[model samples]
Target: MWSTCSLARPPKQHPYENRGCLLNDDVSNLGKVLEATKQTLFSLDTGYVSLNRILCLFEVWKTFEAKSPSGLCVLMLDVAELFNTFDISLANATQPADMERIPREIEENIGSVQLNLRLKDALVTSADHKASNRHGPGKDT
Candidate 1:
């Protein structure tokens, strides 16, 4: 059966050569998949994570990672350990020395007064704009 299938191809050409065309696409798409996964996980509110999300993450990781059943038990064990101790890492994260002072990078204007207030005002204005359904900067009717 396999020999007959090879007869359809031109002589001196291997049957699987055409399959290489997608290799580049597959490699590039892996990065996109990782970025989308990162965004999905990052947007989760607070510490909330569901079993469905966990399974999906695991499946995607395994698909690009192990791709075989042999290594999965250990991978699962490692993932379990990582998730189990993730809280410790988060809890140990350092806080800004002065919470009241907004860092200039995030401050509305570097070296400007009332930066915090400006940030608040910006947020309020954005909310108003969204509510009014007028797109930014001269889209108003």
Candidate 2:
């Protein structure tokens, strides 16, 4: 019997630590698959226009506000893990032959991914430099 496990914890700090762990497997491949999917879906100009429309709708809804009900309205939804309910036929249909090709394509098409990483690294380095500068030559507390 097939089983699916939802990751309860976020990705680890170290990339090397991802190996040998099932939770990290899918996420590791996500970069590649994401790029491939983007390329496949957007090759046609219509797909790009469709994506823009979807984004526009999402942005509008994100800022929408509704009036409060009476004193206050509270809503709750159950958060539970359900395992092994996936349909294998559907899964087999979508599985990629070569996952590594995805990230390569993504790098080629979307320059933002690399730029974003660089920006994040720069920010982290800048923060560290600022922290050291603030300490400023002896005054141990």
Candidate 3:
């Protein structure tokens, strides 16, 4: 089986630590699939929603609220790890046949996949910056 070397880089905002490396190629492929999924959702007319983007939105929305909810509140969940942990049969049960090719591509490109964090980060950060920049400026609402 062919495999590619993976590197773990420390986030610029965080202090460097010698974190142990993980070598699962599927994880890399999973990242690509996640990104493609995000793009697909974004391309559709429905509001684009991704884990980090939604989290960033919630953070911003919280600032205007006077108090946290006392009763039921919506929570965003992270199920990324489920891709690596769960059986493919579980996914097969829900995934449509037309969508089978992407998973196949992911499996085929396992070792070759590159994880994309910067794009998602930029989307969230830029949206935040744009919102803040327009807040005090004499711009049409």
Backbone clash numbers for all candidates listed: 0, 1, 0
Query: 1-141 in candidate 1: lDDT tens per residue?
Result: 000001112223534354432133433354344443321221122332311232222222322232222111111111223334332112110113211222322233332234223322333443454546666567766
In angstroms, what RMSD does candidate 2 have relative to the true structure?
Answer: 20.9
Residues 1-141 of candidate 2 have per-residue lDDT tens digits of 111112112235323343432334554553343333211111112222211222211111111111111111111121111112211111110113222333333346434344233323333444455467667798453
lDDT of 3 at 18: 31
* Candidate with the larger TM-score of 2 and 3: 3
Alpha carbon lDDT of each predicted model: 0.28, 0.26, 0.28
Question: TM-score for all predictions?
Answer: 0.20, 0.22, 0.24
Collision pairs in model 3: none
Judging by TM-score against the true structure, name the best candidate.
Answer: 3
Q: Which residue pairs in candidate 1 have backbone atoms (N, alpha carbon, C) closer than 3 angstroms, thus clashing?
A: none
Judged by TM-score relative to the true structure, which candidate is superior, 1 or 3?
A: 3
